[model samples]
Target: MLAAAALAIAGVAYSSWIFDFIVPTGQDRFRSFLSELEADDVPWHQVYSYGDIVAGVAAVGASLLLFGVRPAGRGATTAVVALGVFGTATVADALAPMGTVPIVHAATSAIAVFSLFVTMGAATWSAFREDNWPIMRTLGATTFALVAIATGWMLGSDRLQGDYLLGLAQRIQVGAMSVWLLVFSVGTWSSTRHARRPKRVPRRR
Candidate 1:
């Protein structure tokens, strides 16, 4: 479980790096789109869009860790929901080269919105358990949920004004949150293994 979480985190970090360095660098068309919006004095939707990308990836990665560590029914549901959102977003992005429209953006936007619900549901469920580190679990879950909600709202409302700084910050947040999940998973796995060890018996005279 811990191992899985660690890998998920690593995946999130790698994805973040790709988005930060690679995606933006070569995206001339996308950048032009943002520039046009700026010239027209429009709010930067590009920034928010990129933010959603990073957040969606991080949410899925964290969901995987939560599933492995807790294995709760709700956790599985959350994982599925997160995956659905990420898949939707990927499809939308792939189709962007073809054209941009309300339909395409709407389809992709749904992913971000749904992710918020997934994170909230999962976190709420996890909070009910009485565990060794209940607080940490709750905190992590809450943090993910809130981030999901914020990103979802930004995407859904078209409030992302395509600011490079905003996009960068969003990516950083996603990557950092993912790292937390990895650490938590490793700790959970280690603790579980330690607790399962057989106890030594005393010999009687």
Candidate 2:
């Protein structure tokens, strides 16, 4: 799922550059948001469209798998629900391209970001009761902090219309979220792998 997300983002970035839709090096960089690439006039817009669809599908499956396993605590359950919301919002973004449905696209994207924030917070809380969960908790906490700070900065400043900071904040939030999910996946995989060990057979009597 993380790989799909990374690739989709890469595809979008590449398409944006190729089409001159967002020249990151230019003065207009601050005004260049991700959604603009999804506009109808952009060249090769379908790449981002289809890539997000694939990523969203992958996210849905991954979230369900994570949720199905060991949902034994409130924090863990919250994480699961947040994960599902993240997937749903991702799919919603894919279905409603910015050009075709700008309002819906923006709304879903906002929800997705909120869901990701909750996911990390829940994971951090859930990790407190499990062995070897410190690393996961630390990761979750760090990611949450970066995103929260960046988002707050974006909201605190109106210069996003004229400065590059908003774009920087946006990338930081998105990138950190993806990295956090990768860490979560690895930690969960390790835990489940060790958790299912079978009992030793009784010695012959």
Candidate 3:
């Protein structure tokens, strides 16, 4: 489970950081895409195509680890669900252009956000319930859940982006949660090592 969690976190971080380059984009794709969306000139099909391809690859990896291996069933299930949501949203977005089907895109985005929360919550629960490591694991899980809920609510309310300080705080909250997960991973590994050690024989009086 620890290994799987580590892999999932690393994969997500890497994908989030490189998603723009992973998609087919030229110079200034970011600015251009944002501008197009603001100007109502964005190509929904192209956007969905790029998103689906990237998300599909991540989904495949997550599915294999979650279902095929079965080490971390709960965490894996969360990941699979998240991937499914993304996949569905991508297809919906592609079929229904934002201009022609604004509601569809809006709904898909909302579902996607909900799925992300579910994924993180599941991961935190998985770590928390592992009896081998309690304190750090539980603390990490609690902190993550609280922050996830708080930030999610703020973002959903559309207040975080409007307030620079709130946005910065949200980022800090997430970053702290990520660090906690990393710490929990290390604690898990240490516990595993201790569990695998041979019992010491009692000394003769």
lDDT of 1 by residue, 114-160 (tens): 55446445534544553432433656566665556545543543455
Stretches off by above 4 angstroms in model 2 are 1-30, 129-134, 158-164, 197-205
Q: CA lDDT of 187 in candidate 3?
A: 48
- 1-205: candidate 2 lDDT, tens digit per residue: 3432432342243222233334322323354555555566766666656655655565566666655565668887787788778777877886897778889998998897788778778878888863434567677577768878877876654354555466556655555666676667666665665657787999997
Q: Per-model C-alpha lDDT, please?
A: 0.46, 0.64, 0.48
Instruction: Give the Cα-based TM-score of candidate 2 against the true structure.
Output: 0.75
Worst 10 residues of 1 by lDDT: 31-40
Using TM-score as the measure, what is the rank order of every candidate, best first?
Answer: 2, 3, 1
For residue 205, model 3's alpha carbon misses the true position, in angstroms, by: 17
Highest lDDT, which number?
2
Give the root-mean-square deviation of each candidate in angstroms: 7.9, 5.0, 7.1
TM-score list, all predictions:
0.46, 0.75, 0.48
Clashes of each: 7, 0, 0
Instruction: Write down the RMSD of candidate 1 (Cα, Å).
Output: 7.9
Which candidate has the highest TM-score of all? 2
> Over all chains combined, what TM-score does candidate 1 have?
0.46
